[model samples]
Target: MAFSNDVKIKALVACARCCCICHKFCGIKIECHHIIQEADGGSNSFENCIPLCFDCHADMLSYDDKHPKGTKYRPDELKFHRDGWTSKINAARPADYCDEHRKLDQGLFLRILRRLPWNGSIGFISTNNFAGFSFDCRALLDLHELAACNDDPSWEFIDPTLEIARANLAHHVSRFLGLIGMNTFPTDNPDRNSVPEEWERERPEHFFQVVDEIHEAASRCVDSYKTLLREGRRRLAIESPADEEPTSKPKT
Candidate 1:
């Protein structure tokens, strides 16, 4: 049988609506997973329930015992992780927990800044024409890495305002990357940027439309990133580097 409302609510509350395994704040995007499958006689009790995010829930269920590629998460391990995380969440005061989250979030924002430096390719893409502009392959890799981290549970901001800003930045970054991937082609020169796809020549209007979309998307990414940086610094007390200028123009 499925977990009852009481069991689900209790598990979610114990984990503060965060994934028990990754500790990512999931809010409404969380599920109460059974530690032991119901088919295996797992009861619909709070003790058998573990709150998890959508991705973690999928991973938890993907273990193929017969065709095992790697070690699967054991039931004992899942219980340990759930109990440990829930204990921590239930023990800490709201203010203290938020303080710890703020510190971790500062580091996360710093990592993001490193990937998208103020005078780096992101800024360049925001200001330059997309017609002949090519983004550095390495920069694209950094963006991909940053995008991947959006789902990572570690270092998720607990502050609602900061979380909202982070989500906005992630959305814009993903949009920018999607537009580029669809419209660009890799070049032989490793040091140079990827060039626009040859198909653009066959459909000039469509190409222009994509170019405008890309430019707008890039601008939104930069704007959202800057907003995150400002909010993180102000609310989380993040320190900016002395040599780095957050307001500096993109490198020409």
Candidate 2:
């Protein structure tokens, strides 16, 4: 079966584009091997696929002198190695490696900034205005982005500041959606009016307060991201040399 780009990306992300057996990165190319061969009744699903370098793939399908040539490797053995390496790669992911997630976070922050009032009062803004915040923002800063982040190790950095900011925004958006008879959350009381009874009691003052708090929290996350980028760049500069030195000095 021909592999789709989505399936290939999923496999690469799961194994970090490395060979499952020898556990070495394949650089640009890695072959997608079926954990259970399709010829042996294996479907072309995600669970049935594994990423391997050409050499490792050959080794998996071959038997050395220690074993008879006719004997082939078992699927479970390959699966075990793949699972172990996937876990190690995910665990070793750098804290500041979330470029895509960071972009989504920034996108949502920009949208929120646009909606906020110049006077810092959200009471004037209706709940209907921010409903789109729940939509997936390129696999970050959205309700569904969590699944993407979970699947991709590179996007797994959990910035506490970003979490707090997102939670603040989600709370406000969820409350607004809840008040409008939308059932996105179990806590949503759809029986209430559009404005909700509790919020009605708090009125504009509570609305303003929530807006101010969320804005401040999200702004802090932005600053934290900038600091993280600076630290990461500085570390890279120190760890990597600008040019490679000669292995031996001149013979003169």
Candidate 3:
């Protein structure tokens, strides 16, 4: 039996819409594949599905020895890839996606919450707060990458917030790089910005404000992602099998 649309969509999202074997982002349509072929009695469930772009899907299905480039993937190997990708994504994904994925997402969120700067004993510092700011910048960048790599329209909700956060972060990074007398930043980066005339070291207060804006934008973006995820999950659940129990976290 063919997997339900819910399972197929969930599998695509869980894998971040990239081919597991080739690890390439597909701009075109991806096909949902069965690790165990349906003809072999494989159940049409999330755990049994994998997402592959057309080329990779064709390669996987081709078992001809003459086609050396076409590597045949074992069912267990595909499952491992799915499980590993799911774990990585769960760290950054929201709980509204799927119940099977939510357990890991919740655990990762708790871990992130525990690491946040909430220590009451220490007062907040202003200048040269590179570590904390850099962490947030990297996180936003990761989310942006996820959206780009998946090419999924569902992630459009957070695009504007990401743009604002990236702009703010880029300005900060450029200012820092300029302080060290570097003339150029990465040219290919969409977020790269030139150091502005007003971004001098004496204007530390203004710099802090930019950082605050970045943090605020990031928080808003995170909330928006959670909202979209909840909506997506709700829609998926409406199409899901009623008796289906969400898969538990796979053994690590």
Candidate 4:
């Protein structure tokens, strides 16, 4: 059964119209997801609802318990995330939105910037040839974690524009990761790289097509991140360093 209107409204308000998982300000692009599947006898109560963005909702449903790959977000974990976010939103005071509180945190912004991949991970994926390539999965893992950091309350920008830009960057990065599949290269060894078996045997044309798609997604991620950085710097009144911008794809 679908969530009732009351339940949906409550969830939306509690999450402040942002996604509970990524904490991105989704505006009207948010959805009420069932923490437990309806097929599993999950109810349509407010307690069973989770507010998520389109990408996060898809990710939550994509996990297959029967053939589990990566770590699945359990129902309890979803509840924890939802409850914690709601508490924060509810505890926020009106004065928190005053001009004094809207000042940008330069140190916080710098820390977040340091966590981003810059021209490293996304740059490599967008510019490299993926054929017969066993990508170092650790890089992707790091990127995912960096993107997920957007959900941390400490990362929230007081400026609405900056926060929106940050959310856009996180959304794009998460979308790119979703397209690639987080555990696409599940490995027993942490140091092992993940090579798509099909890439080795598929027709050259087909392989190139897949590579092109990945390149496009990775490029979008880079663009979103660049936008965030630009907005962040402007909000913080910080000048960009000489080498702050991503350079052209490195010559092989």
Instruction: Point to the candidate with the largest lDDT.
Output: 1
Q: Give lDDT tens digits, candidate 2, residues 138-214.
A: 21224222222322333322333333233334333433323333322222433222222344265656544544443
- lDDT scores in order: 0.72, 0.47, 0.45, 0.70
On the 0 to 100 scale, the lDDT of residue 57 in model 1 is 92
How does each model score on TM-score?
0.59, 0.36, 0.35, 0.57
- Best candidate per TM-score, number? 1
Candidate 4 lDDT score at position 100: 57
lDDT, candidate 3, at 207: 56
lDDT of 3 at 193: 34
Q: Which is the better candidate, 1 or 4, if ranked by lDDT?
A: 1
Off by over 4 Å in 1: 91-117, 121-133, 141-185, 191-236, 242-252
Q: Please give the distance, in angstroms, between residue 88's alpha carbon in candidate 4 and its true position after superposition.
A: 7.4
Of candidates 3 and 2, the better by TM-score: 2
Instruction: Rank the models by lDDT, top first.
Output: 1, 4, 2, 3
Q: Candidate 3: misplaced stretches above 4 Å? A: 64-71, 93-252
